[model samples]
Target: MALHFRTLLAAAFLLVPATFAVAQDNEPDVDCDNAMTQMDMNICAHRDYETADTELNAVYKKAMDAAREMDVQAKDMGEHYVGAVNALKRAQRAWIGYRDGQCELAGFAARGGSMEPMLVSGCLADLTRKRTAELKTVYESEN
Candidate 1:
């Protein structure tokens, strides 16, 4: 059981980069209208992306830790299983792509509108919540 958990945890960690890459790639290019204000806009945009990325990274780390705990438990149970690790990795990658696309689409509702930032932020929050639920389900099932 423990070994199984470790395998799952390792898999989850390995999968995080792909998700992060997708999220980063799909991030909208923030425009700066004036050279004088370019630094400020860049800073604000960077801060926003960093905040969102940090939250998402935290979720991934938590999932990985849970997987590790599950692995330890499985090893203790003497099951000696090694199933679904690759599947989990693939699923995680798919999920990242899904999240990026979904969030980008969500942002379109307020394109060129004053609420664009709000729309995008809301979309990100929604995705984070959904992803959290998915991870919870995976962790619960392992138990």
Candidate 2:
């Protein structure tokens, strides 16, 4: 099974470059503003996803802090409130799972093709930006 997995991985690595070469044959230059080749599109989409992920991380930290504060206030009041920090952590984990699955489904649109990476990354970026906005709304409302 391990050998079979390795063989599949090697074949996938080989096929990806061949697919990219087919795309690069038409457009050699990579311009993020006007991504012409599949490789360029993939690179641009990954960059966008990275940017969104960074923004989401920043928002998540702030939300976590807000949750911590709520937990502290509840403790100070001696009230048996559901832990905000725990709830936020649980919700974030679930969101991550959902995002990964949804983006993977989106990649099925161009499965095994040169455009699959671009589709997946685009979906990731869109979802991450929306999640960041949601975190901001949820936490900022308390402030």
RMSD of each: 15.8, 7.2
Kindly list the per-residue Cα lDDT of model 2 for residues 11-89, writing each as its tens digit.
9999998999889576545679997777888989988999999999999999999988888878976767848889889
lDDT of 1 by residue, 24-77 (tens): 787655553432443444445445555766776776666777666666666756
Q: How accurate is candidate 1 locally (lDDT)?
A: 0.66
lDDT of each: 0.66, 0.91
CA error at residue 101 for candidate 1, angstroms: 1.1
Cα deviation at 37, candidate 2, in Å, is 0.8
Q: How many steric overlaps are in each model, in order?
A: 9, 0
* Cα error, candidate 1, residue 3 (Å): 59
Task: Determine which window of 10 residues in candidate 2 has minimal summed lDDT.
Answer: 22-31
